[model samples]
Target chain A: MATGRIVIDVERCKGCELCLEACPQDVISLADTFNAKGYRPALLADPNHACTGCALCAVVCPDACITVFRDVPTPKAQVALEV
Target chain B: MATLTADITEKLVYQRPDALADLYTHYCPGCTHGTAHRLVAEVLSELGMQEDAVLVASVGCSVFSYKYFDVDAAEAAHGRACAMATGVKRVNPDKIVFTYQGDGDLASIGLAETMHAAIRGENITVIFLNNAIYGMTGGQMAPTTLPGQHTTSSPFGRDIKLTGNPIHIAEILGSIPGTAYSVRRSMHDARHVIQAKKAIQTAFEAQQKGLGFSVVELLSSCPTNWKMTPNEALSWVRDNMVPTYPLGDYKVHEELQSKRGRGR
Candidate 1:
């Protein structure tokens, strides 16, 4: 299976939480810490690589603070899993 | 999918549009102005019109649009964006010229300028942000304010009888024979945002091909002036605003579509 994640540019975020609402995977939330702009930036809650990289956050992000990346499952890893 | 992810740089699915500057804008958090600006910048970059575009910024909240978009910009007086855009378009016929205006500037003070330019069929594009309030001036009642909607000036809610009905600018402009394209789009959700971007792209193309005047009226939200949280404002636009300002294409010329090579 492919693993995916979202990267946020904290300094650019205004903590509007529009991305939090838009996230379908329920992986994003506002951090307790504030950015240079004095707004709490959005952070991904998933640490176990549960992201699907749907890019919904990027789509609704007004500040363009998010970028999505995915990890492709390798054939060797699949063979190891089968073993 | 697994084979593609091997390249790290290939993971770049989305980023800021190159047409946009890196500097920050002062718009309120969660205000749709930022989204609207991004849409225009993305479309301009997609069409490779960054250097050729001359943006005309009008008064009101959208006045800073010039600073946000990485292109030649000229600031227009109150409600005079279209008039200035007309001269800019006329002088530089080869350049793509468009005006970014808010409801207070477009439907109120500069109504005449917008109408006359549309009537004259000037080869220009207009991105009209209809937030239905005076955003920069403390949320006063605008010409597009909904019936019974309250504002700073209309503390008791807007009475259509007293202030007249909210102007349907898109429909009015669509009715003009000279208008090559006129459409209304919302910014409440991802679907509408995509549609809005497409509409903006088409509007710019209409001007690029020397088609008649074009206008893309975006139903955006002003969270700060509305006195609602950003999330609440987005919902308000989905509920209250969408009902009053239904989204659709009012007019699309055949010549313009043929150029884009699509029936829509």
Candidate 2:
């Protein structure tokens, strides 16, 4: 089954560590090296396969650097129109 | 299945609030703090600024405002909400910053910080809740308390000879050059609540546009402190407080322009 994904904007990330602590699925990890701003940005170790898209990480991020996209069921209209 | 009606409660709910330690609020029943909290939360949710917005919670009853608000909040010392908010906004210019303060915090102890922040035209919003009496610290007389009002400190009713007159904070703030928007409204009833919401939303929008300081003074009720029932407190606010405060726009940039003959 497909799942939603979490994307982090590394440049804007302030390395607040809020998302690192908030992600219940334990799929997010900090980068080994710091960015230009000298803060280690958050990254997804594994994609949505392990992410639940609960949006806890996005809510806790103080920099507003996280975005979540969830997979949706295909609309019936699309199937009917294709047929 | 029946179609569900989109209730006002649903629209006002905070969908994306931050998760900090959740402690039970210590507000009286029918207290306007809950409504005020919801208004701010709703605005943050609408603007998608909840993640970046940092609220400065003042002392007095609202000292624990950070608990109720679902955003990044920091507790400031008594009457220093404006200064704390100033530091936070200055350090992080991209974040939407605001201060939640009471009459005592803004008008009495923190008066200097509040005035200077307005004079400097800091790009922030100050949600000033004026309930006449201090709520958190056992109902003490505040700077904005009504004349002849009876409070813990003014047990025998505020004496004009001793307590002096009530301070008109909104009118005073409106006169400042740095203030971009200043509106005094109330939340006594549904009608006033609507107006209060509009004023609050406008202040938030002004911040979003990077405009200078904006303040919305809400005439709230304190039934527990006022020594009256909830309904009576609302009535007192409508009959007495509104007259002294006088609900209306005190200053507008367009008026300033015309007065300066810029339009002519």
Across B60-137, the per-residue lDDT of candidate 2 in tens digits comes to 888888877778889998999999899999999998899999998999999999999999999899999999988888
- What does candidate 1's lDDT look like per residue over B63-111, in tens digits? 8888989999999999999999999988899999999999999999999
Q: Indicate the TM-score of model 1.
A: 0.92
How much is B102 displaced in model 2, in angstroms? 0.4
Interface RMS for model 2 = 15.2
- Candidate 1: CAPRI quality band: acceptable
Give the lDDT of residue B237 in candidate 1: 89
* Clash list (residue pairs), candidate 2: none
Candidate 2: misplaced stretches above 4 Å?
A1-83, B1-23, B254-264
Local error of candidate 2 at A18, Å?
Answer: 38
Q: Give the number of the best model, judged by DockQ.
A: 1
DockQ of 1: 0.43
Candidate 1 segments whose C-alpha is farther than 4 A from its true place: A72-83, B1-10, B257-264
**What lDDT tens digits, residue by residue, belong to model 2 across residues A8-82?**
877656554546655778988889888866767888887447876666665444344567776443454334446
